[model samples]
Target: MLDSYYLQDLDEEEKAMHEFNKDWKLSGIQRLFYNSLVKQLGGFGSEAGKFIWPTGVTNTLEGDLAIKDTGNQQIQIFSLDGYHKQTFSYGSESTKHLGDVACTQEGLFLVSDGSKGIKVFSKEGEMIHLLKSSKADWKHSYGLSVLKSNRIAVTDWTDGGKIHIVGVDWRMNAILKTNVIDGLQRPEHVAVTEDEDLLVTEGQLFGRNAGCCVKIIDSERALKKTIGPTYGDHYSFMNPSGICVDTSGNFFVADKGKNNVTLFSRDSSLSELVVTQDLEGPSGITVTKNGLLVVTDCYHHCVKMYKYRQEFIY
Candidate 1:
């Protein structure tokens, strides 16, 4: 994703070069100013109607943001600049514990609500129905990502771990589970890459070295790459929760236990790029279409936004 802000500085030849090379690279120096904190959204309320323990957030195609306010048991919609839009609760159930939220191409809101499975809602906040899996039962649905071809990928926390890939119509295409063959454990959050691959964050709350890493899985549920304590030198994670990818193939991970966000390059060379400024238990992360980074801080009860710059190297 070439930013027009930076493209204006390049010549015609440079622009053509970038057009030719879709998968370009940026040197470590160019990534020195990769991301910086700029704006903040919801916070602890002095009056009322503010965020409390917001867990997940995702951007809509219209550039608006929908956040899963778990403490309030509702979803809050806001503009990109921190303006409140509207709020809606999922389903008709009395007890609702929202986990994560994702917006489809057609503007439908898919939210994960504990044992209730994924709830589909209309743009006007009308409850559609619960997305039922064709195969595996949703033990504890935690994370969600709208994949290509209108499919949805969600994670189930119980029984070691399980990832179910289903269509918006509730047809399960495939399911990945934890066993001696796969090793997926306590998957928290998920993201779909530009190539349609899945990036899942696996971590545990009360264990060490059991599961604290990010795994890149293909469409067929095959493991591709793992980034964790063994990936790079000095790379470690306590609770790797939320994850998101940019159009440029660069991905970001939010570690709640570490209270920071880490940026991993495309080829996995740069791994220790940590963003810790003004962050307290960063829980969810998402990159905007224009390159702004949005993260939800669970402990502080607010959402932080960052402006990022990208320089491509041919």
Candidate 2:
């Protein structure tokens, strides 16, 4: 059911087209080689294993890094050097998992508790309030993104058909916005831009074409454009679970299936391959004000940093 050699399994006409294109052939070969090496190294064999799992990562405005140890069910804070600065555990024997976390200017943090909805905690990890309760339809509340307007955007993967756009106020009160967008197969991650636009990463679930792509939504939570498909081209994504936009409006996507980070320009005209190596189950992505790219390696239980090589245009 996974898309390991999904591209190679393309129809004859599609295969013939890529066979005649040298660049396409090279890209295919590179993907195959990378996959093989990863398998031999005991990593995920198929694309499905690369994605679908949940992990959270974010960079603080003050240049600190935080990663949720989902496997360990704890939160780990690290300095810019990747040192173990401090870790907060829910309880000694508690298995309550922490999904996504966002830090506010006042050092208050908002974290999602999977199906349990959102939890507000102080800097010392003390519970402040439960923003939203778990509804039977709200299966997996995965990604969280904070906005300058103090509104929190979240992705709920419960029904696997729609995304719930809930607004939260400073008092941690939840407001169910009238804006409920449908047709989302399995919305995994959500990101908000400076312009207040919403970006979501859709993953395949239960025979749906959710994997391998992202979608943009307007301020009204209306579907704007589909970025990629289930497979093919650089535009094609595979189980893309994480998305983040830089200060320049450029979009960075973590293609879990492809084991690479893809970059798209503001106008969607320019698409380029960014990081294609040294990634193990890269689930979440965030960019720092200093232009440093931070990615979460779910299986590896650590976050990796990348320096963006900015290309200036004349």
Candidate 3:
């Protein structure tokens, strides 16, 4: 839910008052009013809905959406109205393929450069830092997650699947790949909850870790639970790739094989399908601060958004 109404949503006079009340969190009544107002003004981005092999996407806390166009090797920014705002590129010999991206609290973005390492860029698209672990052997880093504590988490698909954690100071703290349930193979995508629990989409096409699933790991990197069928079923989860957690702690998993996004409640006791519109091989997914859902459609080479709704707690 929207904790505070964006001043831009209000009239000139009301927007001033909204800014004045920024120090205070809005009340439930105020939130309800703004929620309704926002819904009334809702619309999708991009009239043509165009993209070029977009593989990853993230919802910034500022409500902006960032998409990585793999085919073009460019990062495109879109406003809530679906208008293209900016385009930036960070290409180098080693950082040719920008795998995934995550937005931080201070408008900083962390971009994974496959085996080369990670590159940090400011909100204005300036290159802030390029970090590579000298100790860890990184294969193809795809999934990236920035935790509430400023810690960075990313997955290495090769070397039997591994997750490397970067401390707030931008250094490798630890590597988590062992002690995983059912043998983790290709740990492609990852998401971290407010409580520091890990949600990862892994497993190869045919192997011990076949039939991808989302595994929840505690702060200690121990497996807490798992989602998805052990064998193929309706929920297919053929290649669960991108995963994210909402403010309410609900998880949205983008299954590339299933070509859809599924929602699992905070407690993981209930699950539902929350995406089907133009989900042609949906790969990466994220929920905005106010609960708007966004996902990257790899097959369709486009990005899609929806006004997230829930009959029960998501």
Highest lDDT against the true fold, candidate:
1
Report how far off residue 148 is in candidate 3 (Å): 1.6
Structural RMSD, model 1? 8.0
TM-score of 3: 0.75
lDDT of 1 by residue, 17-115 (tens): 333222224622243333356778878852234787788899987889888887776778888767788888764322343368999888889888777
Q: Put down candidate 2 lDDT per residue, 9-45, tens digits, no spaces.
A: 6686544423322232222211111111111111222
- Kindly list the per-residue Cα lDDT of model 3 for residues 1-314, writing each as its tens digit: 33354544557654443232221122111121122212111123332235666778887657778877666666778877766777787564244433888887777777776755777777888887776645544567777888787767778766577787666554432332322222456787888988998898874468534757888888988778877644222345677888888766777888777676776667765455555445676777777665677777776666766554532122
Model 3: worst 10 consecutive residues (lDDT sum): 23-32
Candidate that scores best on TM-score: 1
Instruction: Tally clashes: model 3.
Output: 1
Clashing pairs in 1: none
RMSD value for candidate 2: 8.7
Q: TM-score for model 2?
A: 0.74
**Can you give the lDDT of residue 54 in candidate 3?**
73
lDDT (Cα, 0-100) at 266 in candidate 2? 65
| 2 or 3, greater by lDDT | 3
Colliding residue pairs in candidate 3: 45-82
Better of 2 and 3 by TM-score: 3
Per-model clash counts, in order, read: 0, 6, 1
